[model samples]
Target: MPDAMKILLFLLTICLGSIIMQPSVAQTVVNKPSAATADTVTVRGRVTDAQTKQGLPGVTVLVKGTALGVSTDTNGFYKLVVPSIRAVLTFNSVGYATVERKLDAKATGARVVNVALHPDTKALQEVVVTGGSPSQALMGSVSGVQSQAAHDRKQKRGGVSVQIQGISSMPRAPWYGRSESYATIQENSFHTARKEPLSTFSIDVDAASYSNVRRFLNDGQRPPRDAVRIEEMINYFTYDYPQPAANEPFSVTTELATCPWNPKHQLLQVGLQGKKVETSNLPAANLVFLVDVSGSMSGPDRLPLVQSALRLLVKVLRPQDRVSLVVYAGAAGVVLEPTPGTRRADILDAIDRLQAGGSTAGGEGLRLAYSTARKYFNKEGNNRVILATDGDFNVGEQSDAAMERLITEERESGVFLTVLGVGEGNLQDKKMELLADKGNGNYAYLDNLDEARRVLVRQFGGTLFTIAKDVKLQLEFNPARVQQYRLIGYENRALADEDFNNDRKDAGELGAGHTVTALYEIVPVGAPPVVDPLKYQANPAVAPASATADVMTVKLRYKEPQGSTSRLLERALRGTATPIVQASENLRFAAAVAQFGMLLRQSDYRGSATFETTAKLAEGARGKDAEGYRAEFVRLVKTAEAARRPTEDPESYGVR
Candidate 1:
């Protein structure tokens, strides 16, 4: 063997080793960590509307030329860790122009960079008009069409002038896609306590309406009239009610005061506070996550938010809990089989892998979820199907009646439902509310990640565990003390007098740590009669008990979460009416919320209620708000007030 040849081979091997050891160009471009890499710098700031100067939530902030990104919180605040001080950050959000900010290359330590984004008028102007004639197209471009037939008729009138006139006369589309639907709510009217002595209704704990209204107000749009469920809005905020007694499931508190909106009338606030149970003491849970990955849910606020939300839930799950993931798009299928919550990583990984596309088969998804829950039914534990969707059921039994029937049947299996509605424009709120009510569960609307955290993390026990079911309230107003009374809100929850005592009748459920409230506007015997004295019938005689100081008798019926038979609870409220200024924070806050709802709904009985009055009331009643939710509510009232004012420059008003 020649020594020269061996030496040459050795040199070639050394060259190959050197080449392999050197980092690739792509890795260097991506700023891969290395011994010489600079320490990470923390970047934090807020994104705001340029005109309104208000925080812009749900904005996406990203490191330029990299995959690293984070969304702003509810207040448009974001914090990100960058590999180097020289990194450039980009801010993007719906309806707003994108922005880019570059950090100082020589700067060290944490950096703060606030950004303001302007509304994108071009993006706002974009609309979809399908299968329309040239004249109809012109009309659509001028003023959005309400229906095809109406536009066609306007087109037949002929001439550009006529077409323009018709366009001006045409009504604007309720929404671009016109897909959102809300149940029509007829405001409760005053009823003479003499003729109708009993007021009965199912207790409601659902707060979807409040968040949904916030979404609309934040976008600088007035929510639809039907979307304002006064009862839900009133109950969205938690009241500082005392805990139940050791032997009871909940505590009842009642306050009577002069109505804020009407000094002539009295306001009666009835609150029930459920016992708070520690998470450690909660029963083991068998949860089926029924996620909608339909095309409509492809928006950032939909499927992606749902994924993030479920991830938060998974982090809090215990070893005794079991989780299953089921997703629906064009079809429904199980993505992950029943697995113990101890395997958090596995559940999270499955959730991360979810992507959105295809039509929504919500009905099929519900059916599949319930079946999966039944298959692994936890007899002694909590069994629930958590459905997260936009509630657009386009395929396979989409009717509300059909969905009610399906949920009603499945609820008999002892598996409760939790419907989390997300997204906008095409949100079928009516359907989701109905499904939740029929399934003997609660409904919530998640508008942002902060809300997701609040629902799945902050209020874990209350959101997932039920303490009472079939809860109903009945009040008998003393004819002698009261002439007419109106039940505020609860229009849809009103139950027939007989239904209150009927055990077979389904009603609202109370979650652990939940608080339910109801309000009544009463007219004293001396107040002007709401109705003319009966034309043909004589006034009924008041009972002997009605002569007492008691103004009304309150009765409640509820059943144990797992029990079929119901138990009765009763209390009496005396005729003493406190001044509005001296009312309890609970009563004042609730009255404020009720007034807010009435103003939003433009209720016939709103009286002197205004946005200013509502905000003032809320501001005074926001006592020791630990979560800052009460503060947020005050801001929302201001936003609503600003939105209601006429403005020439919509952009200045922050119209999204």
Candidate 2:
């Protein structure tokens, strides 16, 4: 064939082939999905209250139809990737009206989509109109809806009837129904020096109350009165008390000053400084992490924070230290066996793999942890179980009494416990305290990551190593000098005068380099007494002793952790009363904390103790705040002050 004819014939064949292949090519192009990244866009914004402009935390942000969703951070910030610009984003919270925002299809780079949610005011009215009490109506509505959904789901599946036992019957729990446990505290009344000359109590070194109080303040709520443990508040910050001398595990110092709240009264300050042992000289640690991976702990501030905190603690462990991990959720199991601290990666991997889902079996976890600790019991080492949980024990043996008995039994095995609480809503503070008190351990609430660092990193030595156990204090006040006196706090720690002499009684343990402070408000002979004079049983004050120039005598008893016998140390308070301005920085700061606690508790004894006064005292006495803990206390005080200001129109927290 000629070259022109061949080329024309080839072009015609190519055109026919192209026409035949066009349908397939078009079909392939149509079936192939576009790149997700090219179509989807990142939406970043914050959620806040419309009226107050305050960020609303724990708000759920989601795509209208997809399962993809995210909860807001503590700062009420969120980031979400959407399938398309036309997609609608929905934001919902417990007490706020639900909102939806449609993304602009034409928008290009990361779009900002901030939203202000209004309070759900109509919810209460709606519930009230349901022809029942507000609470009953609201709960009934929720239950009815959930029941209908379950019924529909059952009908869809061949009309088969099925019931899930032990599952939460309600689809959603009431927002306000979340409850925290706190022990009832009966404030101490004045004890006439003549009748009750000997004031005895166990020394409390736990600082859980301070961080717990800070949590309430941060959440814009006043903490419950029972949650305010004055002694813990005062001892949270490290004081500059002198360490123990030769042959002593701790040193006691005393100061007398005019009470900040009541000028007519005097304050007796007793401070104990535990001897600090070098980290190198400390005993090898055998630690078992009793972590709760329960469903309630499924939040950033709960299990995730616990993992981070444990990681920080792991970084400080030495080769001599050994760590084991035991997790409990519906049941207890050992995630990691006894492993050397050198194998940090293994421990971390175990921790990172932990997921939250199931009821908490805290009692079983404790039993397993104590058993694990005993299996590798370090005779000359720090054998301890660090229980990290939100304190929501819901499974077998969940009662506080049962847990107390279990802890007491395990404590006899010579294994100490460290209860590190995280999260809120269902925090069993009372149970935590009971376990720590009975199990020879200390309780601390880690409200945030910073607190975890503070407890696990900055104060590592004191947090893990106990130098002295069963430490008790007994004070004898001279009736001639102090007509009446009242202990500032330690309502739970207060012991009968005779209990101090009992060696078998369990008291608080003092960790290495830990500081304990106690305050006493004294009413002199001239000061007015809250109690009226007794007509029938008149107790006369003893004559002033001319020989001994002492107002009171303090006696402390403590046992070397391994020893069954306790050693006693006595000191007399004889110094002249110093004005608040002239008092030691430690005394001043502690007094400020006591006053601040009183204010928070709304105690009647908080005479002239305004938040301003507390702030001023704390600011002036924030000495050698190398870790800025005292500074943080000042900030918290300021926050509390702002929260306490009376408002005619209070902000509704949208609890339904």
Candidate 3:
């Protein structure tokens, strides 16, 4: 087998045999025009979503009618250099409209451009409603509006609104196939950490949405296309972390391609293996299912999705794994107890008979799930309580603080928790996140069957496996040789300088074969920093280092899977960058995404970034977008900028 294919198989075996879910490496579409003859002019821009004010990942910046375009990297940044300074850049995406901006002749001296995209279509026709009223779409940002030309600033919702509407237990039998759309909505919100201050985002898909999409289409007008939530996508993949072996059972691959529709924005294709674990080798899992069968779950995406996803998981339990079911509505009750995993029929039978009703007694259900799990705890086996809900735990422990405390106590009992979120409208990601972080477990949203398979079946191990604990990173830059550096993303994941060595410090987890990449867009002493002039007085006493260094040293600290004490791993990034006379595909993709994000938030530090330059640079980086996702990214960039048109009147849109 080819080396890459062989590596893929090996990883797949590891995934199937072990337990732990891994993260995606993040890919990009390079728009680097051939250096040989193309009259390449670099473009730099920030790509961000207008609604959540978050960076738009894998956005494409393209020069219309040419293969000249690039895709954003994991950081939602990109840089492309095109063949001509006068080329027009386009932006497009799945649910967003198309946009474009032109690069004038004065390209070299051009600064960074920021692009913000508003949510375009929230097909009110579909039963699954995500975001806000169409009329409300244009009001996302006061800045975007005040900055926009009066004529163009008019939309119902200027910004995107993402939220969980509520739980619906109603049947969506006919439209089950389209459920992935709602699933993606949850994933998108979760992945973004739901930190964007969206003015109107809400997840309001009715349980009837599954069937309603087709019904809406039958009347001539098409229903709204469900936005696929990717957070759920990654969380769904089950990884087998730290399970050393000759091969892995599954592998995940991300590809950047041109979108089949839009020529500007790029398409990012994330795929995983399809396999099942044997009934044997599986641990004796004491699983207590905390299902929110409240009246709120009366929709197809809520109760039905939860029931269907659970049924899929039930089928995998072996005779050795013990199962229990706890349901919460007006009252919490144990529907099943200590059932054998091998008795799949019995477990699913119980699930099949469940019905949603009454108020959500979420706290009561938690107490019961814990009580049940502790009763069946195995010293040498897996023990966990999985909560399936839309996050409307209103009846009990409704506050985030209460949920945090409960999760903290649950972790002490040696019974981990995994949250399988369903539906959109009423999800409380903040509460679910707290539960997962404190409980030493994880959280996910089950948007559809594809997602269910990705999370429950394909990545069962990684999702359940614990390899290392308290993973933290401390980059010790040799200040003597360096000027200044910035750490991208991880705003919330950042660790205090002291947290690096503290073994007890809780931090992000990395699954086996999972890669956590952080970039330090640095400025050498000789080079200018992204930050403006020092805000404080200069340290005259502190002498600069005499010698110059090429790269920074990175130190990684992690604890053994079961051991609390910490361990250390170190690696140094070394390369002699010759002033970057010209940029590469990789460099531009990251830069573009960053710029796009900065633009969206009107970040103070988006130096040298502009939609025009970003477009040109992204145009330079379109490297092998076999699936066309990258090309689509460029289009997304254009569509976003055009929607809020930075070109019509740059000052009004605050392009500076």
Candidate 4:
């Protein structure tokens, strides 16, 4: 501005200019910090009920308008990281009104934001009482009504129990706006072995139906008839079956026992024990967690539970493995790139940052997840996409048929899919099941944290690593020894007899260390036939092999995870049948489960099967009870019995 010699006045002007310019530079620094220089603020707080002041677990705390969030722990404690102290946070939980808070802009370091949410009256009002005949209450509604009445009586009597009668016919109305969907399940009928000697179906390793049914029972509601898949129920529990010998992927065991339901018939238990693979020896994994953070998943049981379940899997991740997270809600995007499992904290941080609120673009999410998995495709390793959602796809490619096609096409790339279904009321069980089936994967329903542990931790190998795919089972009953037979379940898994040998056909995936079981009820030659003899044609002469003591032949087809051609396994079951009381624990436990399923389904063929008998059988057969799962099954049977209508005849409930 001036030559120093020119004037002191020139120097004064330069000094003023320097002061103004220096302040402007300082303001710029304060307003916008460089990306690398910016600091993340840590936020900690608790979420509690407004009225009760009790801590609320699974409350979703989020940085408003962003995907970053965290769910409160069991004691309602939560800690989150935000870009700045000025960030706005939102807290959401089921049955509670959403709450929002803005942080102090002038604050520094970590911040604290406690929230107390009030009950949402509108949500509570969704379930209202209405008058209807008990018969019109559907499978599970009567029990709910009776429970409510009993509660009212207890309250009136000052906690002193009093028998409430004449209220058996009362029915509670269903909650409004539920959209859960299940494919119809028609019970299998007896097939005259003389006419149809073969039974064919895809082996279903999925136990989603069993847990889903248990959810209903625990809620004091009878599961929907179509929701009870007997095969899934029987296979959910582990059996003491021998492991496969060398060069085999699984071992097949067969047991024949007097049918607990119909003593006149026999129960044949077919168990497949997949060869166990130690976790340390498993191939490196390339996994893409396709998480749904849609509006529907905002519920505590949905996204929150998903986070907890996935965390369990993460804990077992090895350094050689890699994980990527892709989330979808109105759109699809990858929150984390392919990160090595060694970066456990980074992966977990990414998971904790997830928040739910938007429409579901499930199809788009699948596309992105597969693309991610393929980009980091690990040859000679496990490549898979783990999808956790409520199966509610409302925004894009929403139909079950559309999802099935998309998953089917994506699976051809050798990236398997594992659908972890959570939440209820709007759970699209049919869609999830179809996706898993078509995607050459398995599905499990996480009803509680215990189930999450069982699926992701206790049975880690069986949950994530696939040893065999396209597994199908076919049984040829010896018409000479068996007059008629019916498969206990696998209604939807039925396959054309020819499909067993069709290498190109898709079937179920068998995970490492997984156990699959199937039950068959057989009417021996001397038993009364379920149907009159065919008048048009006489039965063909029994072959020499059929005349032997062999009751049936079991044939199984399977393909290696990476193989195109299938391998075969076969075994013949002898006709000797042991009394039900003397059956092995595996046989008796499995029979008990099948009997309970029949009773629940009210199957026409459930001869002499009673809840009391089911309980007794399960109680006696709960050997080794290492995990207490068998004992839990017995408890569930008792629960179902207690919930049954008082006036409903035991015979109608599967008792002879």
Best by lDDT: 1
| Candidate 2 per-residue C-alpha lDDT over 238-341 given as tens digits, one digit per residue, 9 for 90 to 100 | 88999889789889999999999999899999999999988888999999999998888875567766876787688788999999999999999999999998
RMSD to truth, every model: 11.3, 11.0, 24.1, 14.7
* TM-score-superior candidate, 1 or 4: 1
Of candidate 4, the 10-residue stretch with the lowest lDDT total is 136-145
**Between the candidate structures 1 and 3, which one is better when assessed by TM-score?**
1
Per-residue CA lDDT of model 3 for 1-656, tens digit only, reads 79999999999999876644533333222344444335666678767666534566545455564434554443446676666766777654324434677777665654365677664532121222235543333122110111112212222224332122222333222222232223212111111101111111111101122222222222212223232221221222222222223343223333333221122222232222322334365456778888988877776566756765776577667677788999999999989988987787678657755767789888888888998998888877777888888777768788878887877777777777777776644555556655766676766655444345445654565455444445665655554434454443334344556767777666644333332223344444444333344457563322444433424455556665456787765545443442221534544454455454444334444555566765665556656543333444454455444333212333332233
Candidate 4: pairs in clash: 69-353
lDDT minimum window of 10 residues, candidate 2: 137-146
Q: Show model 2 residue runs off by greater than 4 Å.
A: 1-177, 539-548, 644-651
Per-residue lDDT of model 4, residues 35-88, tens digit only? 623767889998876754656665667665443566676567889877766677
| CA-lDDT, candidates in order | 0.80, 0.78, 0.50, 0.78
Q: Which stretches of candidate 1 lie over 4 Å from their true place?
A: 1-37, 42-82, 86-177, 539-548, 644-656
How are the candidates ranked when ordered by lDDT, highest leading? 1, 4, 2, 3
TM of each candidate vs. truth: 0.81, 0.74, 0.53, 0.73
Could you give candidate 1's per-residue lDDT for residues 310-409 as a string of tens digits? Answer: 8768879999999999999999999999999999868866875677779988888989999999999998999999999999988987999998888889
**Regions of candidate 4 where Cα sits further than 4 Å from its true position:** 1-177, 539-548, 644-656
lDDT of the structure predicted as candidate 3: 0.50
